[model samples]
Target chain A: MPPVVKIEEIHKIYDSGEVPVHAVRGVTLEIERGDFVALMGASGSGKSTLMNLLGCLDRPTRGRYLLDGIDVSQLDRNALADIRNQKLGFVFQGFNLLARTTALENVELPMLYGARKFTTKQIRERAMHCLDIVGLSQRFDHFPSQLSGGQQQRVAIARALVNEPQVLLADEPTGNLDTRTSAEVMGVFQKLNDEGITIVMVTHELDIAHFCKRNLILRDGVMVRDEAVSNRSFAATELEKLSSAEAAAKLTGAKT
Target chain B: MRFGSIIKVALRALMRNTMRSILTALGIIIGVGAVIAMVSIGNGAKAQVEAQVASLGQNVITVFSGSMSSGGMRGGWGSSPSLTIEDAEAIEREVTGIVGVSPEVRDRNQVLANGLNWNTSVNGESPDYPDIRSWKIASGAMFSDQDVRSVAKVCVIGKTVADQLFANGDPVGQTLRIRNIPFKVLGVLDSKGFNLFGQDQDDAVLVPYTSHMKRLSRRSYISSILIQAASADVIDKVQKDITEVLTQRRKGREPDFTVRNQVELAQTATATTQTMTLLLAAIASVSLLVGGIGIMNIMLVSVTERTREIGIRLAIGAHGSDVLMQFLIEATILSSLGGVIGILLGIGSSQLVSHLNGWPVLVSTASVVIAFVFSAAVGMFFGFYPARKAAQLDPIDALRYE
Candidate 1:
């Protein structure tokens, strides 16, 4: 079968006054199904920009991005939005849960945006199922303010997985988590990957990048290191260091 | 997205700001209330005017003693024999439109009962007087024409008089001693409430003209003559005919009398009431305008406050129409609430006025409906721009709004 993702020389040049800032320049890439890849780059290295183009949130200036083998660059805004709704799921740095909404309601918001939502009683039941996957089934009624940072991020991951999307676009998913909590989050991603959900995440952290099977490093909007991670490891045992002596504080995510 | 979900979200957002919603509805309340109250007051005044006109008797004319010149104290001004019983007879004989003619002799006397006495008017009038005055007897028979020609000593008492003399029993056939002269009771008159002259029409008695002529006789003079034409349409013509005849009888001199009809009086009073009602409504509508401004102001504040919420809703795939519909509904709801409150208050206020001032105020259902509809329209009109502003917001900037 054809590749699950494809890019044909995609370019993104943002107009800042008279100067043209080349946020992404002629980047060509592809990934097969069930691939766990990390787009690694420094600040302004076009990795996040390429992720956005793939997420259908922004368009490439002069190239085609074939997400799941569908050319997104030629599509209009509404069509692009339809693809975003149907195919892709997002997890951002700040965990972007609706402020006043409960965790379950936040997970249910995306399902409500698609057609057949009214007839989709299964959408509500499935939201619970995803929350179960993220280990937040008991906190379905808790609002974002009532949950800790790690719990909030778990809620976001539950939202991304609730649709059972084809690809997960995680923009620094563990950027706000502690070192131990980051490992715990990576363990969840690895487990989801092993269960056949494709993950394409962006990060500058070397330890975070090492958890994925494939890595693409970028500098000045150009890929310089495209290599396979040697061991494709996760530090799930790092969570054991905080599990003892400070179990309550670490589990509750208290500063102490 | 499902419409049910949209509505649920909108309702939740509305519940977030309670005071603003209530304040927005205040305008609609005042507008509707003012309309209902003004209409009720107008109805009251119209009815009052009709009743007052009824008291005077429609199409009736009056001819009085007047304008005696080069004479004594009661001489030059009102000592003329212009309204003699002969002239009353002449009008009865000559005027084509005159349906009935009653000559009157008004006098003030101490009306003596068993022990109580009252200083009430005693009208000396012809037997045709009841028909001429548009009167209906409540209890006994009116004196027949025989009472006028044979000059019987019989009288009809009004309701106020009957209440005083025969407080527990019938006044018919009872004898009342007027100026030490006994007159047998003939009938009791139907009540004619009060009039502009501050006189209760029921507080008087009527006697046969001949009996009064014999007891307090006059040569050819009457206090006033009561005349009813065949209909209101011919009243003015008949009045002109009577005045010309009387003027000629008084030697072609101006007759020095007032000729009035019910239509003119009703028109004058109705017009006055209508103007007063419109003025009241205009005054009340100023409050409605202020309420509208309050709605607009609160909407602006709401738009400012929910920027982040707007962004979240948009990002979750809320369409532009959804945001627009939500804000518009909020504005309409607010205005309708105010309208309801204003209607209740307006009716209450008008009822209070009616009770305090003895005026009739009727709040019509038509006016109430008008007020409610007007408030809703105003809400939509004032709510449009702010709602549009909210709907058109860019999700990127809105999410970043503090």
Candidate 2:
């Protein structure tokens, strides 16, 4: 089977009157199925732009973007949206769950726009299943405001996965979470990846990038490094260590 | 997605800001309410005119003395007593479609009965007067031709006169003195209520033309001639025939009388009422336009406020058409809901006005339906630009919008 995502010489140029900004320039890359990859870059390094292109939210200025053997660079906006709905899932840094909506409703949103007609009952069941996978089954009726930052991110992840998209694109999924919560979120990603769902995450944190099996470094809108993570961190083990360390710190403070 | 689910989504979004939604819809509410109320008032006025015309009798024609111009001073129609009883007789005999003719002479006189005096109109009419005027005696009987020939002082009192003179007691067979002449009340006429000009129709007493000509006005000429046509379809022809016969009798030297039909009078009255209705509806529609503008303004603000949400939806696979449809549905729902509330308010207020002011009001179903559909169309019309603005937003940039 062809790689899930393949980009060849993709360029994104933003025109603002007199000055043209080259947000993404001639980036070529490919990701195989089940590859948990982290895209690491500093601010203004075009990682977000690259993620947008991969998610079919934008068109490249002059390049080819093959999402699962389909060239999406020339697709219209509606067709691009259709591909995003059917073949790709996106998780945003802001945990863009609809405000005032329950966790289950937010999770069921993507299925509402899916190409496959899903009955309301089926949508509910699938949403519940995805929420269960993210360990948020108990928070189904809780709104975004009622959920903690970690739980909100988990709800957003469940929303992304409800349609069963092939590749999950997460843009700084744990950027707003505390260290322990971040590890817990990463553990969900690890579990999803183990179940054969490919994930490409964009993060600036080196420690978070270490959780992925591979890391691609971007600098000044150019790919600088693409290498396997020789020392991959297991998120479940890290979360365990974090909880024990917090427990020990609390005990020592009490003794003092 | 199915259309129902799309509407469901829109309803959910609107419910999130329930207060704002209701406030925004208030404009349409007032607009539609004003429209319905104004239309109902107009309809009521028209119906009142129709009832007045019907009371004037079906297919009845009147011949009034034409305007009298003396020394550049022009007097209105019926100013001169040019119409005579001879003219009425000639029309009755010569006109083929004439059903009945009555020569009328009127005077305002003080009438006394039961030791109480009331000033009212006293009219002299032929025995055929009741038939021509479409009036019926409520009790006793109308005077016959023998009474008219012998100039009997018997009179028929209208409801208003009877009530003024006798109160609850029956006026029939009672003696009433008109202008110091004691006249026996032969009967009481049924109530006719108010005419189109808001004048009381039941404030008169009818006597024989011979009695009025000899005792009351003491005039040989009649004020006007009332003629009933054979049927409604022949009123125009009968009026023309009267004009021809009168013209021939006057030797065609600027005919002295004017022939008029109730149909024409009714048309004129209804036309005036219709013009008033249209003017009121037109003025009320301006508020509906303003309401539409209010919708557009609020929708624009809503689009801006929910830009990020729209981007998120678009990014998640919602087409631009979907976003557009969602906003459109939201606006339509708001205005339609407003329409329903306004219809109820309009009906309530119209009834309230009718009850308080005693003005006739009719809430037509067509007006309600028109106002509702117009409000919904206003929603769709005004909602387009804002929905299009939202639909045209780039998902990537919208996602970054604050």
DockQ of each: 0.24, 0.65
Per-model TM-score, in order, reads 0.72, 0.89
**Worst lDDT 10-window in candidate 2 chain A:** A111-120
> What is the C-alpha lDDT profile of model 2 across A1-256, one tens digit per residue?
8999999999999896589989898999999999999999999999999999999998999999999899999999899999999998889998988888899989988888857898879999999999999998988999899999999999989989988898999999999999999999999999999999999999999999999999999998899999999989998789889889999999999998
- TM-score between candidate 2 and the true structure: 0.89
For model 2, the stretches where C-alpha displacement exceeds 4 angstroms are A247-255, B67-76, B79-86, B93-99, B108-120, B145-154, B163-171, B174-184, B194-200, B210-220, B230-234, B248-251, B267-283
- TM-score winner: 2
Which regions of candidate 1 deviate over 4 angstroms?
A: A1-33, A45-84, A119-123, A163-167, A213-230, A235-256, B1-7, B19-138, B141-155, B163-169, B175-184, B190-192, B196-198, B204-267, B341-372
